[model samples]
Target: MERQMEPWWKKSVVYQIYPRSFMDSNGDGIGDIQGIISKLDYLEKLGIDVIWLSPVYDSPNDDNGYDIRNYRTIMDEFGTMEDMEQLIEEAKNRGIRIVMDLVVNHSSDEHEWFVESRSSKNSKYRDYYIWRDGKDGQPPNNWGSVFSGSAWEKDELTNSYYLHLFSKKQPDLNWEHEPLRGDVYQLMTYWLEKGIGGFRMDVINFISKALDLPDGTIHPNNLYGDGSPYFINGPKIHQYLREMNEKVLSKYDVVTVGEMPGATTDDAQIYTNPYNKEVNMVFTFEHMDLDSGPGGKWNVQPLKLVDLKRNFEKWQLALHKVGWNSLYWNNHDQPRVVSRFGNDGEYRELSAKMLAICLHMLQGTPYIYQGEELGMTNVVFPLLEDYRDIETLNMYKEKMEQGISHEDIMSGIYAKGRDNARTPMQWTSEGGFTTGTPWIRMNPNTDEINVEQSINDSTSIFYTYQKLIQLRKQHDIITHGSFQLLFADHPSLFVYKRQSADEEWLVVTNFSDQREQLEWKDCDVTSKSREIIISNYDTLNTNENTVEIRPYEAFVVAFKKGIEN
Candidate 1:
């Protein structure tokens, strides 16, 4: 097939709505499909074309809706099928396309397929999931679940084990089963036919597993092994995606973004290359993973600006010519970015806007999580009992077992817990989200930080995001520019340049709270030809010699037409 023309997804900005936290129309304390439908006008004014709703599928809420029991039905807590249909119609009326989360990496163990597969060894659905004989008297291998403990759980009746990379309630599907692939493809087509614009594939790359089930190498202090090698970007992942593209994706005007935790730019290029027809882009956690300590996500450390700069530059440069990227900092699985990467105290708004600039300046599609645009900081729950995330709870239990202090584990949770980003959307001084009570406690600072306040204040972080999205829509430099990292080793300064054939844009952000001087003379960008385009602070000065930027001050300078002359 010939290359398809540049599509709407490339030009549009996407807003991700974690359905459970966005709003509650029924006063049921949980955000639902109708809640989302009620907020389309708000999203339209924010200028996002695509709305990515996280899974509202039927589930046991074991992993907060990521575990799917029925692929086609809506969760009872969320709403009914008619509510989802109205959501689609209303969003379409407002020029917004809806994209559902595709969670096929695993399904809820309650799903009929898993139920049948687990019933008897000779069942027709037994091969639909990965099953293996126990090794000696233990789990099949040393593989550990991503949530915690062992990846394999033995069925008492069958005396065999089934694999679950996540919670025990979610079983990994067997991609080697051609019939299973057809079923998934058929479900995808069903959604596409219903006017669902596209999909944000959940752990899409993990569908393929290694042919040989081998024990992973063990870490020194670990009880089990790192089982990522057994599933992450395994041998058949690309082939499976290509087949998926040919069968479902390429047939419609749609966009597909795969969530790949351990993939590199080279791997991403193949997954997103237009000619290859696999996906439109891939979300690589290389930049987001910067704050994780060597032990991984639970062990949080200070984020090194140099490391963050390096990773973003590498992916931007690597995918500049070959493919596409989906840029993000806040997501359901991550802590609030402003809390993790920015100063949340006196300079909250300044630092939040600075972080936004630092990422949005890159050449890629940007995703704004539900409350990210309002400069939402992490929730501070003094007691561990206040937290609700399964990952956070599991980590706490494991750390307590390891004899770590309550303060130490809570410190890590404060810095990197997924619950930090899962709080309900602050929509009013009182009642826009819920009437009686919210599912999660509302951040007490909502009076000053909610959507009503942000929308009223012209200088709020919310409006800054609006301007950023508008700029993206109007500028081709954003869509087709090549990236160049300005100062790779700057300790407190993060600077980069985006260049097209005739124009160049320089984005400078001070990641720290200290004032810094830009040695523009160090780079070839002549100061005389540049014009200030965007900045968080009102005043920034560029004299003949040095450009002075204030604490957490951020701005973009664009080289005008014929500046080189």
Candidate 2:
């Protein structure tokens, strides 16, 4: 018998790059593939293993690149196909693989298939999208769009409505159509053959909706109905994924992570289980929604530290050996993590390092959103016109129409808007992103919190991330060790231990501004040979049985199992 080798992705750290905000090479105001190519050395210096590049496919820009108009063509604004290929090659040269964003659940309404599907009721492409007749002059179903209002958009030409789970421009694809599935597989093959590393699937679980297209039940204090039960993790989802794995994913030496919005631990166990051959891992939203109230994402609230700890503990324990988890705190659709989880005002650098240690030491492939390493804070634009995201703008209009005050709506946007993560990366103080005007406003604090300054300063947040990534490469315990939550009920501390047969790594993080004390006895750290592997603080006070933890402090201590005090 032979021991199975761990997958390459298990030990890799992924850095997500929203290309439009990364850099601008041609003074076009939009970051292009060439711009990304120019930053390969910068990414290499950061010690990232993979770059998960958000959608660069041809799009109409309705929902950014998520509403792709063409699957095989590169977006005109980003670059030409040649530039994309150059980017892949250039990144590989520096030992970094490129992972493309796969958004197949929906396509731009201007897509050829959608155009033909709507041209006539008898068209061959009509089955590619979900369409049906209206009932009593209303939409086919009472489901609401994720962006706002109604999910169903009426097509005036065909005298019917097309289902769009997100923006009206993004029409949901009918996976029930065999040819449609085949088309998707063929496009995936097209990319895999291009020497790309893998894919970060976008809202993949929503692909297989119920064929009945039934009306959803309305929730309290909501104008529209909840259709998540019908579409999210719907019937035949597993079957479709199995088919995809068999037809395309399994054929490549590539990793796939599904962005499952409403998946449970049980569902993920099946979706990412090696035996199932569905996806390599899944991006669960449970932790991301901890700050949201019952009303949902726009209804923002402060996050409870215990709740976050328990959530991570659940996923870590559930997927110990059965499945895999893709760990992330910020992405293109979420606000900056330092602003959300840590004190971004006074202790930005310290809290950022602490947060990095908390997530990177966990048992999963960690994803670092661009500029998050520099401790970027959330942007609070004074006027609504400064926002560019469709979801944020739509929510504001809908809420205001319902008599919500400007201050109330702006507060929510300030706290939870997707635009926070979409701001142009602060490479330098003098508009490092573009020579021309940026499509979206840059964070005004870029002068003080830019990548140039962070990279130059050894004590900056950038070095903390670089060190964490390097540590993950050197230590196997950080990646494959068994995870155990310590001080689970602690109000201001997130403490956990990762242990193997002979070595153990204990991670301690103080989530608050006040100083906290940790008695080593509580953590069962009786070993005398324990060493402080990393810490956000300059120094630490420690004895045989106790250690004093400072404000927003974090550190990892490694212990040799057989050592005695």
**TM per prediction:** 0.97, 0.99
Q: What C-alpha root-mean-square deviation, in Å, does candidate 2 show against the real structure?
A: 1.1
Candidate 1: where are CA atoms >4 Å away? 1-4, 561-565
Put down candidate 2 lDDT per residue, 1-565, tens digits, no spaces. Answer: 1224768898899999999999999998999999999989999999999999999999999988999999899999999999999999999899989999999899999899999999999999999999999999999889998888999999999999999999999999999999999999999999999999999999999999988988888898678998999999999899999999999988888889999999999999999999998999999999999999997887898899999999999999999989998899999999999999999999999999999999999988999999999999999988999999999999989998989999989999999999999999999977599999999999999999998898889999999999999999989898779999998998999999999999888899999998888888889887377888999988777877789888899999998998765
Residue 528 of model 2, lDDT score: 78
| Cα-based lDDT for every prediction | 0.88, 0.93
lDDT string for model 1 (192-311, tens) is: 999999999999999999968889989966789887887899989989999998899889998899999899988987887888888999989888878888878877878899999889
Q: Which clashing pairs does model 1 show? A: none
